[model samples]
Target: MTTTSARRAPSGSVSGRARDFRLYWVAGGVNLLGSQASGLVLPLVALAVSGSPAAAGLVGGLGLTGRLVTAPVAGVLADRLPRKAMMVTALLVAAAAMTVVAGVLAAGAATFGVLAGAAFVQGVAQAGYESAGAGAIRRVLPADDQRALARLEARNHAMQIAGPMIGGSLYQLARWAPFLADVVSYVVAAACVAAIRTDLSPQRAERPSFLADLRTGLRFVWTHPFLRFVTFWAAGVNFVFGALIYHTILVTGRRGDLPVSIGLILAIASVGGLVGALAAPKVLQRVRPVVAIPVASWVTVGLVAALPVARQPWSYGLLFGLVFLLTPMVAIVFQARAITVTPDHLQGRVATVIGTTGEALRVLAPVLAGVLVARYAPGVAALIFALLLAVLAAYATANVRKLRATVPAVEED
Candidate 1:
């Protein structure tokens, strides 16, 4: 297995890296706030527009579609082109989409078609931005900096905790508000990407065919055992977990529940995730991912098994919160491993391959959850998905029992 050697970063290096990352982090936080607000309302908008659970599924699925279709190409470009330029372009595309949609909403047209179009466009842009995301970090931080990785995940968890509450409040006031926030965020993100003094361009010596480069990435991951397992395992979990989220939202929304109540439920889950993020470096120090991941997976089984008894959305939220608590450690473990294990030139491709594959099943998750929850009792649907996740978890645990992970020590923030 390829690995980045452990090292103590010089104090000057640490300070430089920290200074650079702060700007990027600020931009990402701005982006996350908008995405969270929009994420909360987009499906509700769909459900309101068409009054069909399936339409909600379709609109949500379309966003994933845009991501899946462009991810591989985005990865290649991230490796060949200037990452900052690509990110700026992506931000512009997303901002334009949100701007147009908000304008339509202001004009009082709540059409499903326009919302779907905007979702797809935004998703495409998101994929492009993500393809460059980790590569950008590699430019500033050492690959082996586990604490920095944990901090990155922590920011996401923090945003997750805050986003729904803010989104819910804004949604209560006006639907157009969140989309307008998205436009402003994109501009901020673009400026941040452009302002970074670091050279954030690919440094490859040769240009290969797109297909060849893609195949090389695929081949590398396929040859690795742990990455291979995570690729499929994550997909199944996403499908099941995604079902639960959409099912809860759709069922509750159909019952005339207010957005704030739903946001609180989502925020509760983020609270757990935030705790886990805060503890990730400590957890990773003591526990092997091989143990942590599978244990978390089984714990998830127990949670899902109890889902049948969750009578209210808040009850479901608590159980799901526990599930998310296990996520940040496991999530940081895998991503940090990926960053340290893969070579710099290959980071964009390998990261994207893993990312693109991980999310592919998510497209179907909302649709499947929508259909199942709409057609069957909540308990029965929950049980069915629970059993499905149990199998995937068990399989992943067995395959990875012998594998190991290596992460570097924490750096001063």
Candidate 2:
């Protein structure tokens, strides 16, 4: 059996790499778009269907929980199966789940329970699909191309800028329309993945029970000092980001003066991410990852903490601009670091672990943020998030020296 780390081909062939990236470019891009569309629409749907903000928070938490459950196993599956097949299957399953959502909506019988159940199934499939996608990229591309692929990953962030706005506009036309569109996007992604011809080299592992394999993934992260610190940093920052995201919605909806729509918020956030993604490679090329991580983290914390204090709409706009300016840079650097530290064969499992942790934090943030909103004040959670981020920023900087020493083995395009 072949493994991604063990396989090597001559580098710097444009035609060959282009052919491989086409599958990721098309399928992955569409998936990102569909996901963005669904992400924005789902919360709105939850709000409408359930008529309770707490229930909406539960929907997000439950979805994240499902992703957490699948992440460990998805890594094993990515290593075991053909990557292309796994990605296609995952997309197909997600599409089917969306179709179920559409049917429930069309029947005018949708409930919060139904949405939660559907989101759980869809979230599991999404984790599997992403694991396979990450593993496939590790198999197909050379090292330099992988870095460039990080830019493409940034495109997903860019979509975040546009997708919510688009979904929100579509929602105005009809409540069921966004889900219908999401289903179609998934179908297209499935077809695009099927069109790709590259093979995913499967590694032979001793057949372990699923629980055992999961333990292996967890233990690997625990024993590795760099992985441990990086995961901790990612988890902490993600929790802050998740809290900010929910609060952004709260600010827009709860504030009487500023009637910023969901679309505008998504656009603003995405714009920030796009700026970061575009600048990531350039920044990494200049500054060490260790230096960049703390810088970006502090900038984000500073901006978010100030957001709630901004009494006027213009103040929110100023804070929003600053957020888009710096946070995306942090995200790209962190992601590139994650990709570089792990061996190619473990990319899927590693990504799964990373993603699951982030999602789990997202789940926790909403529940906690909701409590803050319910008890103390509207934007109190954002203030606490800022303080927590400040502590984590210091932690990341302290560990930066250790992480910077682990230079990736360079391969060419």
Candidate 3:
């Protein structure tokens, strides 16, 4: 393994500068599709086996617990190990787990324990794969290539929209089909990653204790004001949106609206996300963070605030579309800024610090929304989440100026 600096990348499209990035992107896209499809289908598999909603939820939670526990540890490993090996190993482990599920299903011997175990193992492997891949991509691509990052955002949204549709269709055909599809996706992704020409090795010279390495990751994020603020902001945003989407679907279903109408509303919101992700590069490129960051924050605030008023299906779709439409644009701009400023050695740690916090907080979003919907009118719940977004919006407006002054080297592409 050899060491190279992320800062050494030449100025160009990431694909042009890092010839291996095309492979990286393909690998990422395949993995995203597999993960999304499996995530939705796994709960259904559990439901089929156990015939209990609680059992299904527990199975899903176990998977999330696996990821949450492994995520921080994986970040340290990503910085200490050869990233390519880590990535390939992670994919193989996950694929093997899915193989077990597929085999059991085919044998007509699928059980709760086996499927649950496989899901948890898959999640653990996924965490490691993501932690390593983030550092690897950052290492390969030019630090300033915001367009490439935006492309990743677009890929995620596009695949996410397609994954569940594909998964549902496949599951109707055969219970084991989605799991097998995931296995094939993993094999393909692993092959793509293995083909990358970049040197995907750790740059650090000294090894630290596990606890010490974990502390370093947290310390780096805590010391960086922009990163610290954005971490909390992201968590809040995730929480609000998660609740908003969940409740919209739930309440719509309860009202006996045609499934197609409800699906259309959600589908429109997803389309907005896809469009936002696609446009994020251009939006990020043209806008200066000083001006862009604050304006976008307020725009989200306004859109969320309007959700309570969108009662009809068409209106819901339009308003939710507008809300999500701006979300990826703002988020990608923030991601571009963070990725550019993070050092090569600390990339994995910094990413985990922020990502883990956001996921942890987001777990509570549905609980809060459930309670709110049961007790109050939908508009009141919307107002509460809107207030949360407003606080972050104000924080962003106040902090962007200082971050600009302090981190002078990072700028919009």
Candidate 4:
């Protein structure tokens, strides 16, 4: 396997690389806040205009469709173009789109069609930004500082909690309020990208066709046993976990017997994820990935297995929260290991490929969950998904152990 070592900055009070990473991190946080806000606001806007829950759902689905369609192409561009430039352009475009949407809504001229179109554009821009941003991190951070990377991942998870709350609160003030906030965030994110001094363009001798480049990324993941195992394992877990969450919300709404708010339930889970991310580096310091990931997976299986029987809002939230608490720790170890081994030239494509695999079932899973809940009981749906997760977790644990036994320690390090 070919690995790219991190390039160190010249000696000084603070390295240019370190400064640039800080700037990039700020940019990501700002952009995430905006994106999360828009994610909530856009669907609400659609529902306001059309007065149809299904229509609102369609608007959200269309955004995901845009992301899914453009992800591969965005990945290719991230590898071919300058990473900072790609991020800046994507942010600028997103800012402009959000600005227009905000203006239209403020003017009382917004329509469902217009909102959906803007959402799709924003989604496409987000895909490019995320692809380039991943490459930028690899370029700026020292490969050996896995703890730093884990911290950044944790911060991003924290934003997941903060962003939506900010958005929801602003949305209550006015429909346009959250969108205007997003517009400002995108502009600030663009500025942060512009401020990054370190050059993050791909350094390759010759470029291949887009198809070939895409295939190269796929082949790399497929051939690497650990990456392959993690990819499929993550995909399965993501799918089942997604279904479980959706089923919880759906069943709760249908039953109307919950003592707590669904939003609170989700917030608790998000908070748990943030805590997990924050604690991951410390946990990984004591336990290696070979040991940590499988243990977490099995623990996740036990937590999920109990979800079917827990119908009370607090009980469900506690179980899901515990499940989410383990997620980021496992994720950080896998991601840090993957980034350490992946070459810089392949970073963008490889990151995107893994992201695509992880997200492949996101849209489908909710739909499947709804069907399952409708066909049988919510408990039945939860149990079935839990079983699927357990099976996947077992498979992943075996593969991780086998890979650890076969691979050299230095490769993982």
| Candidate 2 vs 3: which has more TM-score | 3
Candidate 4 runs further than 4 Å off: 1-14, 142-144, 257-260, 402-413
lDDT of 4 by residue, 317-396 (tens): 88888989998887777777676666666778878888887787776788987899789876667678778878987897
Q: Between prediction 1 and prediction 3, which has the larger TM-score?
A: 3
Candidate 2: segments with Cα more than 4 A from true spot: 1-14, 43-61, 107-116, 145-149, 258-266, 374-383, 404-413
Q: Which candidate wins on lDDT?
A: 3
TM-score winner between candidates 1 and 4: 4
What TM-score do all the candidates reach, one by one?
0.84, 0.84, 0.93, 0.92
Deviation from truth (RMSD, Å), model 2: 4.4
Q: Could you tell me which 10 consecutive residues in candidate 4 have the lowest summed lDDT?
A: 404-413
Residue-level lDDT of model 1, residues 224-293, one tens digit each, is 6766776776677777777778887887787788876676678788887887788878887898777888
Ranking 2 against 3 by lDDT, winner = 3
Model 4 / residue 177 / CA error / Å: 0.8
* Candidate 4: Cα lDDT at 154: 70
Best by TM-score: 3
Off by over 4 Å in 1: 1-12, 43-60, 107-116, 142-144, 171-175, 250-262, 311-313, 370-380, 401-413
Clash total of candidate 4: 0
Q: Say which prediction, candidate 2 or candidate 4, comes out ahead on lDDT.
A: 4
lDDT of 2 at 171: 83
